[model samples]
Target chain A: MSRIPEETLRVADRLAAAMAREMRDDRVAGAALPLALLAALLARALYAPDLVVLGSLGLPLAPSAWWPGSGFRLSLARAEALALRHADGRFALEDAFASVFRGRFAIWISPAQVDATGSANLSAIGDWRRPKVALVGSRGLPDDAGHIPMRYYLPRHEPRHLPAAVDFRSAPGRTPEDGRRGRRRGGPEVLVTPLGVFRFRPEGVVADSLFEGVTPEEVTRRTGFPVTGLPEAGRTPPPTAEETAWIRRLDPFGIRALELLPPREARLAAAAIAEAEGEGM
Target chain B: MLASLTDVAARVREASKAGRLVAFGGSGLHRKPLRAAEAIAEAAVPDLRLLAPLGGPEVDLLVLAGLVRRVVFSYVGFEFLGVAPAFRRAREEGAIEVEEWSEFAILAGLRAGVLGLPFHPLPGPATGDLARTAPLAEVRSPYAPHEPVAVVPALAPAVAIVHVPFAREDGTAFVPGDPYADRLVGLAADELFVTCDELVGPGEVPGPALFLAAEVTGVVPAPGGSCFTASPPFADLDVRGAIDYLESVEARLARPSARAAPGRAGGGRGR
Candidate 1:
């Protein structure tokens, strides 16, 4: 075997170390990090609890999100990424995930969008073959930085039986596109980096003025690749009283990865936000 | 034989420059570092248009870095073995052209090419995602989707090479797995070169290798050389050698010209 350079060796070591975390509390949850992420993320995001995740190779989320029942909340001093649940039976793709988790929402963020660059699994969100991990926001959970579908209480699409509501703005990338001028689109808003903290947006990613200790190149390279655009320090939009009443319930962290839309693409972004009735993102 | 991977890259660069339509295929980037790296560097040529089954580091870098004009692949990530950074970057840039395929369908297409058929008819569940992407997969009742299309034109290569564990003076050889693709590629070639561990005789050709003797050319033995082509157990090129070669030809791969004289890539590796 070739003796690897110290730098490449270091990168490899860091990657190996970062891959050892989990988000759930059961043996199946911790052991089946891949299956859980695929199922939970899709369940929570698209409100499709039945979408079965087939094996997808190269999907990094597996080794990344090690456990279950985890959420990415910024207000906490510490964080936990997994919870416990019995292993559901095998999954079936022919079954429509779109209908199962009809009104759920699970927020997703790429490693490219986070400051914890190493924390991000580059192929996790990109791959569709394996049951990938769903622990996103290695940067942080989404907030109402901009778009708000007026947090509904119950699930949205399953309008008849279940209802949900949650504030999905400020949390991260602009949802529903055209809704926000490009400023709020394309990139993640909150960033928790190994180097420091920052935010990203369509205009460009910027180090919070307070953490000027890091360089943009350092941020970009450390994050595995170059980063652009970030959310601007602009006016904050408040939710209307009418919009607040609309959010009734939520059902997050119960579906699979295939069910959720591409977080950044307009054609595939999440269409509705269901309250986390009893689930986690 | 080339002294190192750099030498191989030089050949690839020359092939691209001569207007040869370059085609590349391999399983994924896993335990095999040398072959993987060489594949990445070769695929990163600037001017040569990258043709792939999907988008990933090599294909992406080829496009995003402006080395390749376009890429043809079904799914980049699905095709990745484990580590793939170059593909992710290329995809993010939208400097890509996407084509979709099922694992079976893609293999069938290659088989069709190897078999010298125009297109192979597919046979499988032709519903949902696979249907939307593989339009050619849709055919008449007997010519169902996913079966190899009717006639996959041959994929004759200007020069085809593969990395193997063994090779000998007379040219007979053996590869680890199902050698269908390599067989087709070799049959479709005017000159086929294989780079292997050492020049072995009948003693090494066991099991599967024992059977595939007539199909292969001799292994071009080179101590510091990397088998810069098709793979299995996997091997690498000389590192300093690779660095020296790629660093020197960085410019050639960035903005390739469309001047390839694509020879007829036609033939079949009769299994």
Candidate 2:
């Protein structure tokens, strides 16, 4: 291990501490937070996509839970030590679950409900004991949110999903107590939906940018909580010609577009794709 | 032991005759032993308790066949296609008992079973409705005492069916990348059966072999057994086939006659 100068080490520590404080205070909506986070990371000269751990890359497998040999063991202290070792500009892509347990990764997960506080609900819609609707139980969000940066991806940005307060806190966001205690190094980063990208601020969820043809009025009217649009918030940029070509090439079946479309349209598109693929076969 | 697919299916039927807990191995949409599951479904076995850490078509198929009495699972859904059709329908109809756990909790439970321990404690505090709904208990560590650990009970399956890319007649298998808790499933089951795409000769088994060969009760050569999901080296996921299977099942369920005719033999032909 290369020995770092004392002054450089102290400066890095101080910068990290400040960034953590700012991250704790920032409520995550979807669009601009990525840029903000990226800028902050770049300032620290630690912005390497390869070095940044990812929770999943479209694999069907849900991130693993606590298994000694399988998933990373569920020990924060041990995971912290592991994270410390990877504080250098290199991250090992050992296991998705391992990287998650180390709390040095970012995740884009869909939750049943999200609140202004950035808390996520993926467990149940009704009461805890006898739920009217039982969702997939909290997989790793309970252990993950406080430790790792989390960005939400919701197909629909409706009042039902963006509730005032989630029924259950599957993955906790910043709160008054959290702020006071300086807990949660990693929390909500952004919430991306079809209509717009949102960020969590101390006040509430703020609209960072509306998608093409989406209006601020539509976003505000749809959200369960009061959503304020940033003064400079504008239309989300359309994909560049090159980007569009790349996307078309990579996703010939338009599977990624399924996430942005309505359910009925998505189903139709899927059926069409299947038919096309069937014909090819 | 090396056995024919039909013979292995027969063994599964015999082992699960008592309405035993049968765990299906594989993560969502990846190398699921669906062929074995299909055989069991075709046999029209009933009253089996189903278990999976992360399930896809394997769990849904059994549920659709009306063979599952109870389901102990972390998550059981088609990845992007949305909620599993049969599992969702069964849950909505209150036809099967559901015990939900986190992926970690399931792993911990299986680990407990593998170690012959009564329970295994998950690190950190339990969160969300799972802490209330899941079959977990709280016990303080003797050393710490201050921190209470959420403990999941041992979940030993009566039979575990796992799919592998390659295996030998002696039951040794090559599992590339993540086993996805199949090893745990093998060790935690009373009888572990593996269905492989290629049943190679003893010396022909390739890759770094790491699995419960000793615990595996039987090995069946089942080429393309993990289809519709994935079995790397043979093929990637047959997405169209999977979607077609889902739609076909949904259509069948929509029919009035089929509504009353679940668990019927020969139901596996839809796939």
lDDT on C-alpha atoms for all candidate structures: 0.31, 0.62
| Cα error, candidate 2, residue A37 (Å) | 19
Question: What is the C-alpha DockQ of each candidate?
Answer: 0.02, 0.17
lDDT (tens digit, per residue) of candidate 2 on B1-271? 8876677557667666866678887766667888888887777777778887878888888888888888888778766566677777777667888887877778788889889999998655565456655788899889977767679899988888889888888888876534667777888888888888887886675765646468778888878787677665554556556677777778878975675333221222222
Candidate of highest DockQ: 2
**DockQ measured for candidate 1:** 0.02
Worst 10 residues of 1 chain B by lDDT: B262-271
For each candidate in turn, the interface RMSD (Å) is 18.3, 9.3
Question: With candidate 2 superimposed using the best TM-score fit, by how many Å does residue A222's alpha carbon deviate from the native?
Answer: 1.1
Docking class of 2: incorrect
- After superposing candidate 2 on the true structure, give the runs of residues whose Cα lies further than 4 Å from its correct spot: A1-47, A52-94, A123-140, A165-187, A201-203, A229-253, A271-281, B4-20, B210-212, B260-271
Model 1 spans with C-alpha error above 4 angstroms? A1-281, B1-21, B30-46, B49-66, B74-83, B96-98, B130-137, B141-159, B177-181, B184-191, B202-207, B210-218, B222-271
TM-score of each: 0.38, 0.75
* Predictions: Cα RMSD each: 18.1, 11.2
